[model samples]
Target chain A: MRDIVCEILSNKEVGENIFEMVLLADRVDDIQGGQFVNIQLPNKEMLLRRPFCLCDFDEVNKTFTICYAVVGEGTKVLSGLAVGQQLKATLPLGNGFLLSGKYNKIMLIGGGMGSAVLPAIARRNKDVECVCYLGFANKGKVVLEEKLREVCSKVVVATDDGSYGESGFVTNIAKADLDSLGVDAIFCCGPEVMYRAIKKTFADVNIPIFVSLEQRMGCGIGACLVCNCKIEREGKQGYYRVCKDGPVFELKEVVL
Target chain B: MQRRTSIRVERGGIVSNLKVNIAGVEFKNPIITASGTFGFGREFNNFYPLSDLGGICTKGLTLMPRDGNPAPRIAETKSGIINSVGLQNPGIEHYLATDDKWLAEQDTVVIANIAGASLDDYIAMGEKINESNAQMVELNISCPNVKAGGMAFGVLPASVEQVTRAVKNVCKKPVITKLSPNVSCIADNAKAAQNGGADGISLINTLSAMAVNYKTRKPILFNNNGGLSGACVKPVALKMVWDCYNAVDIPIIGLGGITSYTDVLEFMICGARAVQVGTYNFTEPMGASQIAKDLENYVKEQDMDINDLVGSLILNK
Candidate 1:
């Protein structure tokens, strides 16, 4: 990965607490859908860099977008970053989600802000048919629904209080459609609680579930062993560097 | 912004003296990546060449492979970070079998940072290191995460001497005892290492600290506590290095929160022959190498020998 100074093209809130930040910088020659970029906040009070998944990228304009929520001190600083400001960024980090085949239909599931990782999947595999399932707390919390619709073949948005597209959980709808959809693969990004729900709901279904993990990270490049994820690769069960070894893994392999 | 690739590259009748001799090992420069911060150098080599660094200390290696502590091992605070990774490493045998050959070819000095459960483990690993390609051995007896050895030996002066003498007796390469900052008397420990025949000494390791979550009223780190490092610790490190400089005759390799060329210079003026860049590497992908570059520029611009800066600080009486 290369470190370069990126100029903020735009920074605006897209959802209740979520924001979409666009940057103008050198063209990222190699960007996989699930890969991420680590942006350093220009403040001295916050020393660690903030990592974001690639929400959208334009190769021609050498621009990339990161969709973030003001969750902590760092992101609050990121949200306040004005247009035309410069920030140091290291791009195209982590092993992106490995699609099984080039030509295969896939099911993508996102929970709340996890929807930010969905559009990239469909963006990369344009040839493959992508049906998406998104779950949000309510209409106010929903994000990236339209962005997913622009890339995927179908988009099903669900809210807990029935304030949006459909009522109940999105997983239930995806589970019902799984039998007939005959999708070749499934990819998910969400909280551990949601992963538990998916694991219990899809245990009988035999499709390989791919997941992107989120962890507090350091070095973004994997030297510092702070961001560790447990997974059983081969027969050995061990902790892997989430920054280097993953951020993406086979659902069954992820110990958590 | 241009990088001077060699140690003594002369231009306009100016000889860039970025070279440093620590414990009889000649480093092309004074920039070494701190152990446990920079892994085997494979991941970072993708950004820059390994030869750009003057030295590398491998992740702390134990006799047997360790799974390390549970997740939430790190928490970032203001201007620094606290971590309790517990030295999760591939074991010394794995390194010698797999990573040793590759590290040897990196065209820079490799200092093996080894920790252990007991004195026997330290001596055994030291003896075993002779069979590898490492240029020096850095005894990591200051890790705060583990329960048995590490920090236990680093706190008191007598045990520090014993551990150093034990490793020095068996290890063929020069032995540098890495000191912990959490001790009550850092200079005494430096003198202890010197008394035990240590080739050199490096200080200070991360200080013991914690980060708490007020909402849950619990600790942020899974280990409850960890060692803190970053720019915040530089002042503490400089003072400790100066204290140790007055206490011992052995070469000093200073560390703790080193981020820039001036920080490197401060360590040298306080009597460090060389310095290691730690938490800053996590800040900048090319941090350690970049610091070496910035230092080279300053050295060339001044046309001065870097050695003259060692212990050059003047105090008001």
Candidate 2:
């Protein structure tokens, strides 16, 4: 809702190519799960601000954390900064995962680095029983397993190769265990390919499935119309802005 | 050379002014938020008052709602970014219904930036927006993203004149032709628009560029090549603005890579009556208003008219 300066409380690597940065923000009460912050890097020559999801937050301390992989020039420069550095941050962007508390139990599914986004969902809905399923490329790529366990009642992890936890894709395991999940809703954040697979895997299920999407952005608001995705609303297909309209959407409404 | 002024009282009772007139329309200052970046003045209003800037150019509006291009619409390079949004907008009718009333109430001058795939589309948009409260109309003859009739009219001198004339024939507001930098002679196009009764002109639309990933042997943007904008394009824009300033008699609004107060002064010295902050709006949410504030302080400090800086660049022998 506003752009303010944030000081780095902590910045360190959690897993292969993944970094978790904690910042003391001007305010944290406005943020929610599945929403993101657009950060302006320290270098003034770089004209564009980078968007990162709100991996976690402590509203009492006014601190929020973002987990990012070194994907491009922006993150490379970002990863080099030390703790105590100050940077400009725009907080509480995007329509967050509206976790409906009407159900007794809910499922959170994460693929690869997406595990970072699940813990916040569980935190937002502590009144309800929460379960999680995490998928990673291998053991070296695994992250957030211990973090999720602290919040969710049950946590399941799997690797594509047999290098860690249970073997095989997490989507496959979730599909196989669909009968006993006994949950009312499912929320997932992962690659686009995983969404396609989940749509096919959970085709006949009666439960509601929600998904979070990612895209390159400009303005990190609805203005630039850069980070747009196709979605179906009122039986009409159109491009909706991922930064403002949502980073979270119902799987049935998504055109992917 | 002498400059014009509209003076206001300062805190200590001293007089200072940041106002300038372009084609008979007065702007509070020379800092205007460029089209495609500001989005109808609502988002930036969350950071500061919309009236802080001299004016705001709405997102490029078309006749019908455009789906735009697929994802990966933006790609970043050193000091700049390339975007292929393909003129995504909610259509003129949608804007008139939703954002027009809100923008009219914002207490700032609003300029509608319009684009199209055909002459009829441009004419229809021109007539449709006249009923709205916007004070001016900007003809977008140079969007590199909307590939069809956009580039075809932008690159040619004849087509540029025809598009400007067609819109001028129907629209009641002052029409400012926005020229593209990806053309052979941008000055010729400026002159063509003036000949077609354009009130003023703004330049330069982003340069045609691309970012590639050699490992995948593929371009970064889904639409391969896109229009480039940022600090890297400032020098190129300065040259084009100066060239057009000498070639035509109408006022010029300079843009491309403008990020700060110094950049605004430079653009004014190079012959821009006003400047539009585009790529920098993405970097700083309150940037356009900040530039306006800085420019006001500067003019007050110098105790001179801001208009005196326009076209003041001294040439080398």
Q: If scored against the real structure, what TM-score would every candidate get?
A: 0.96, 0.96
lDDT of 2 by residue, A32-68 (tens): 7889899999987777888888888888998988888
| Window of ten residues with lowest summed lDDT in model 2 chain B | B2-11
Model 1, range B48-86, lDDT digits (tens) per residue?
Answer: 998998999999998899989888998999889999998
Per-residue lDDT of A68 in model 2: 80
Off by over 4 Å in 1: A100-103, B1-14, B143-151
Can you tell me which runs of candidate 2 are displaced by over 4 Å? Answer: B4-14, B143-151
For A98-160, candidate 1 gives per-residue lDDT tens digits of 563754899999988888888877887677889999999899889888888898888999998
Docking class of 2: high
RMSD of 1: 3.7
Tell me candidate 1's TM-score on chain B: 0.94
Model 2 lDDT tens row, B113-144: 99988888889989998988999999898743
Candidate 2 differs from the real structure by a C-alpha RMSD in angstroms, to one decimal, of 2.6
How much does candidate 2 score in TM-score?
Answer: 0.96
